[model samples]
Target: MSEQRVASPRTFPTAGEAAFREKVRGLRRWGRWGEDDQRGAVNLVTPEKVREAAGLVRLGLPVSLSRAFPVAPAANNPNPAEHYLRRRVRGEHGEGSVTDYAGVNCHGKATTHLDALCHVWNHDGMWNGRDAAEVVTGDGVTFGGIEQFADGITTRGVLLDVPAFRGASFVEWERQVTGEELDAVARAAGVEVRPGDALVIHSGREAWDRAHPRPWGAPDPDGVYRLPGLHASCLDYFHDSDCGVVVWDMMDAVPNEYGVPHCTHAAIFALGLPLLDNALIEPLAQVCRRESRTDFMLTVAPLPIAGGTGSPVNPIAIL
Candidate 1:
């Protein structure tokens, strides 16, 4: 089926510096957990929360929410992951050993990865106001890196299927999912966004994939087309709900009304929140539709890359 694209004009709210600052201050979680806190909003996932999430796995059905990484660079992936055989031990050295090394630029439109707290920064600093010069050095991020999530992440997953809420197969690229729409969808789906929930917003990635067929990686693609994604205002909803982690299939819309770009990242940084970008959630959406449920147990464990800004993750949803 052909995909629907939004073409209507709309303006993004809270674009001015004063308003943006207030927004940031209103939702910021800095010092909430303590100065030395590294988990950011993820600290909301307490043992009791994990117990509650476990109870949601009645069917014991686990679905992966990661996109397949491409071997060669595509039109959208300028820096595709590199995997090569590093060593092979044979003879008396060992019974048989084959080792492979992989290198990836986790933050992009192609790979499914987790953006650590240090991934985004503004004039102020990184999460908890850590000076960028001190935290992010030539070596990499010394603080708020992916190592903070080394223990792994597990929480209740809430699927906000905007397409379903809009009664469409896929929302058009020009269309942006607003915070009000997020709340409406949650109410419609009979689910509620609770504190520490891993909020996964599905903004027509399935529909776009079906229409485009090929993966995004073409040069000058931005001039060619835009992908459907959440509006910057969704951060406001996230703040109110106390979302621990925000996951999206396509990220955010481009050329928004807000003069400041990457407001999504800015809001996250202010709130000391982590983000999971470019997730594959079509199968999970289908399962949710069939079961008439939008909440499940989610697990995401990123590589323990010390001093790394982010890490590729294969998030799983267990129903």
Candidate 2:
């Protein structure tokens, strides 16, 4: 009988050796993945990597999610000369329009706006950690302001187009959107949500706007402007998942109704989640329609103002 070569004495690593081996293996396993997946992995070596990973672990991850709309303040002509009082200057140079923009209301034309953390205040008056009243100075300036976020936002973004699933034109506001509706939309969009992602909802209102531009100066008839929104329960779901931001096609989470306040705003803002309101959804919808993709890269940069309440954002979606 051929003598079977005896296997070398099985050497068990010592406790220290085993732990060290595990450390090395863990490093290789965690650090070898792609930037997106390794965003929150252990053994993230650099400070930036650590921060990215921590944000992912904290907020889950974001999807490229935002829409661009053409918003003209005053909804008339956005031309500077038209909106602002202009003085014709006669110099060696040809005549030019010098705008006297002292009294124009910037807030009215803030179509692509970010809801600063200070935008909402609980009845008790606490904001983040500081008292709400404290953050807002006597003159109404806020601290830890949205200006801090002016550096273009970068993160994973997810889309949930509920109206698309039903083949409906748009979601009507104040309609008590249910969790079941959300699940159906996810199914239609083929999106699998993870924690910490910015949730963007497209209600098809933009398409409606394109088809029927809100009459230049006509007031939106009562109840004619309603659109679908996240149910109150949906806010609970996102809060539990550690989502950082929510971008919507409409101005609020729920439709504007005579008797109802925006509960979605109350629920989310109370938890420190910033909002991207009145976002344009046409581009996002087009991308979804063309490529059939529900995810992409979303980049939005808000104008940095020292103590401003909110800022207009130029949001871009990279497919």
Candidate 3:
């Protein structure tokens, strides 16, 4: 047997690209907000939506939807975070305090981060069709920067717990979730993932990682990177539901059948939706199950890093 060739992260096969572009064309929101808009679908998060979401906090409980900062290397974290400590030590009586500096390369599988509209792009361009070469400058992004979300993304959030919905402990790497499964999860949970809301999908990626204890995102002996996550078809559901952000434990399944790159991540530009990736949702899942409800007030404030492609984020789900 021979090692399989992986698709270039930036390119797709002829037929695959054609199929993907066509699928995305129908869901595109190029001019829905305005020709000059940079905020994308988050524009749907009106004041009224925030207030309504706030009203759902009956228990006054908040669950963190973020994974702990990856400070040490692990099977999934190859480039661990950078942390430096400075001690003000005249501390004979422990009077002095300690300060630390931290830096992260947060866009990969390990870090819990928020991907801005400019994080990804291709021949179709970025959010609102701005050319990547033009917007993504040498120093920083000129358009659709993470700073555009300075006020934060606060809206109603509902979890679609696939493990609970499918009666499984975790999803298999070979499996891919479709739009129909999402809809079914919503129905089963008795929740409505309305427009301008955060749609959290708990795919049990963290749990799977713990159970398997292997280096995910790294190619296996067969040279294929495989993971369990949503398929491109889920984009149709997103468009139809008009979701503002997609909060997920897992992202696009690796070695996607699409034969295209950024299988589901294309939504960042295609539908102008932000993606909250690598969220740790098992705790949130446990709470939702215990409470018998899934809807909550989801809030996340990205670091005000102007022109950044994305930001390491800690989102909270208030129930």
Candidate 4:
């Protein structure tokens, strides 16, 4: 399939990553919050911040940014979600009430979920630079579990619509969403990625998946997962902005130009940034465009699962 490549205002990251690597070297914020900081950037979402986010709701409209759960098994979803229903039968009414249960394995290509700080690891260690073993026990993670967000995450949500900015249907492999592109999109949208903002980068993943159906996380001829994802170069932008959380429709382009594994995911380790993965962003983009604004009051409440690594979430973008 030949995609009419479009021009970008920024440089593509595929050239070389000497600068990207240097950014990674200086991106660790292990003790930035504190020695035992369970909530990394969430601390940025202070009560005052939440109140400020609430003020953004001029339209009183909400857009869901989550994908339906228990996705069927496909090339991308190896572990299909489990769902079943049951009813209490009554002679006259046939049923008193209906109940359904859903089991979701949220940490992968298929589910829209929040990634806990303990989700990823690097040579420097987990969030706050703790040892992986110290964080994860036999049963579940002892530190930085999904439950940390039980109080909920309410902040200003900013959308950086890459496809719209580039006048393309979706992000292409040749022009990955790089850090410079992020800056460009934010500037184009006339929004600043202030601290504690739920920065969402819409790479048109839903449209791209619909247009080019393939295996999830499938590697290419280069033996690397090629998806429309944020390039590794974005680490500098993320670190510099000190955004509260990093949310994306396309997570990371693996074995990126820098040859780092899940390089963009380094935000989990380096910046202590919570990552909201597999978000259904097409609707959000539409709402933003319709409303003529990209900022909204974003709220995400994680299921209170004790010791769980992460939880399936239905993130809400209230406009």
Candidate 5:
């Protein structure tokens, strides 16, 4: 048998440039905030929404929704987080200190991170039609960087526990989760996804990865990686439902059925939507199960990097 040709990352407009461009135009949120706005969809998280979210924290139980920051290299993390001791126990003070650093490349497959609006580009532009070349340079992104989120994200969170609904430890590897599956999970969980909610989809990918280690590089000869993730169609639901943020166990599908590798990022770019990728949703799942509730007060703060494209975040959900 001959090997099949897989789509390359640079392959423009897998669904044809004309149709993809029109789709992007239809969903694009450029000027949704204003001609010079930078916060994008997150602007939907109003003060009223935050106050409402605070009301949901009846139990005041906070559960961490982030994966352990990967500090060592692994099969999945080619460029791991770095750490150094700036000072150690010395002198009468016996003071100690350390510094930690990581590049975006350190985050892959399993790390929990937040994607800033400048993290992706579509049609050679960014959110609000900002020129990619001008906004993003070798120096770093001058606009739409993580600094836009300095005040932090505080809103109501709705967890669609797909694994729990399916009664499985994890979704099948390489499975695509679309609006249908999301609706089913939400219904089964007895929850409704409301506007301005921080929607989180849990697929149990991290648990599977921990139990089964494999060489993590390119896809297999079959053109699919052993992971589960969101399908591009999910973006429509996100936009129609007016969700402020989309958090997922994994951001992109291993190998999408549509053959459009960048569909998720492209939709995110067009819609000015921020993404929370590789979130550790299992803990949240457990907490929801224990409390018999899925809605909570979710809060996340990204590092104030003026020109950074994304940030390593530790989100918390309080019930």
Candidate 6:
């Protein structure tokens, strides 16, 4: 059996220590930090040595993980309409008038959306410590409001490109990606799963949609949309890491035919890790391929819609 490798505990500098470093650098700066400071203090150390020291200081907890789910007006439109509503009017003074409106059904299973804290409530009637009633309104509500995540999510991201690792461009329809498959993909990627890192799995499911289009909100003939995703063991990996979040390119891990609540969802949610479902990961794949690298600066900012179960996100990556 393969040994289960665990991540070591990590430490980071306190705010005060960071401030002190900034102060010292400012004193030596000829207007900007690190300018004159580098000339004087850095002269004693080579650039590579300085870089090594800076790297140590810069090391923090981990990267944030999140993704933007692409949205369209209709669930299964062959030419899915963008979320733009337009109204036209005829007037004597004006040739024509048009009003644009846009609304999305992000809550639907197929839509790309973040599961708000309220989206799930334990049978015990509490969410992250607050009473479900207190956080939820008469209509239904919860905390860690969508607005709370607007500033942006900060955590580590680990990508397990299942399709690429499998030597297949895409996963076949209705095919369930197993935990073993996920581990194999991680191994192929040369990444050691770590806790606190957002696990992103790309099964090429999104691309499959182009060739095998299905109703947006409806499941495929197999009773579930087939997509590659983390297996049960991957969930254990997340649990061990104490990960703050999990995002995926597929709608969910289990097929609809199974008819039972998704095990992956139940397991992760039980641990309080928020799920970002229906994520767009093709771009991330492109970036990784172009650079021959998997790590990069990933930013995800969800819409600040108070009382909403979930919201659309515009996520970007800076390599």
Best-fitting candidate, scored by TM-score: 3
lDDT of 1: 0.79
Error of 2 at 252 (Å): 3.5
lDDT of 1 at 64: 98
In angstroms, give how far residue 131 of model 1 lies from its true place: 1.5
lDDT score, candidate 2, position 277? 70
- Tens-digit lDDT track for model 6 on 173-267? 44656667766777777866654455677777656767565632344464433333443345455544544566677644433222333435543
Local distance difference test, candidate 4: 0.80
Encode model 2's per-residue lDDT on 32-130: one tens digit a residue. 233222112111123443244344333233333332243344332242122356678787888777765432222222255676655654344323334
For each candidate, the alpha-carbon lDDT, in order, equals: 0.79, 0.50, 0.84, 0.80, 0.75, 0.50
Query: Residue 286 of candidate 4: its Cα lDDT?
Result: 93
- Cα displacement (angstroms), candidate 4, residue 52, comes to 1.0
Q: What tens-digit string does per-residue lDDT give for candidate 4 at 154-265?
A: 9999999999999998888767788998998899888988989889889988778777757435444344355667777788888888899988888776546654456788
Ten-residue segment with the worst summed lDDT in candidate 3?
Answer: 1-10
lDDT of 5 at 207: 63
TM-score each candidate: 0.88, 0.63, 0.93, 0.89, 0.87, 0.63
lDDT of 6: 0.50
Please write out the lDDT profile of model 5 over residues 197-279, one tens digit for every residue: 89988887656666654533335555544345676778677778788898887556545544544566665578778888778
Clashing pairs in 6: 63-155, 63-156, 64-154, 64-155, 195-241
Which should have the higher lDDT, number 3 or number 4?
Answer: 3
Which model scores highest in lDDT? 3
The model with the greater TM-score, 2 or 6, is 2
Weakest ten-residue segment in model 1 by summed lDDT: 1-10
Cα error of candidate 4 at position 72, Å: 1.6
Q: Taking the tens digit of each residue's C-alpha lDDT, what string does model 1 give over 1-319?
A: 0112322234333355556566666777788889988888999999988998999999999999998864577766767898888566678868676688878878877788898888877666678989888888888788899999998889999999988889887766567788889999999888879999999888777687677755532323324434456677888898889988988886766545544446677755788889998888889999999998889999999999999888889999999
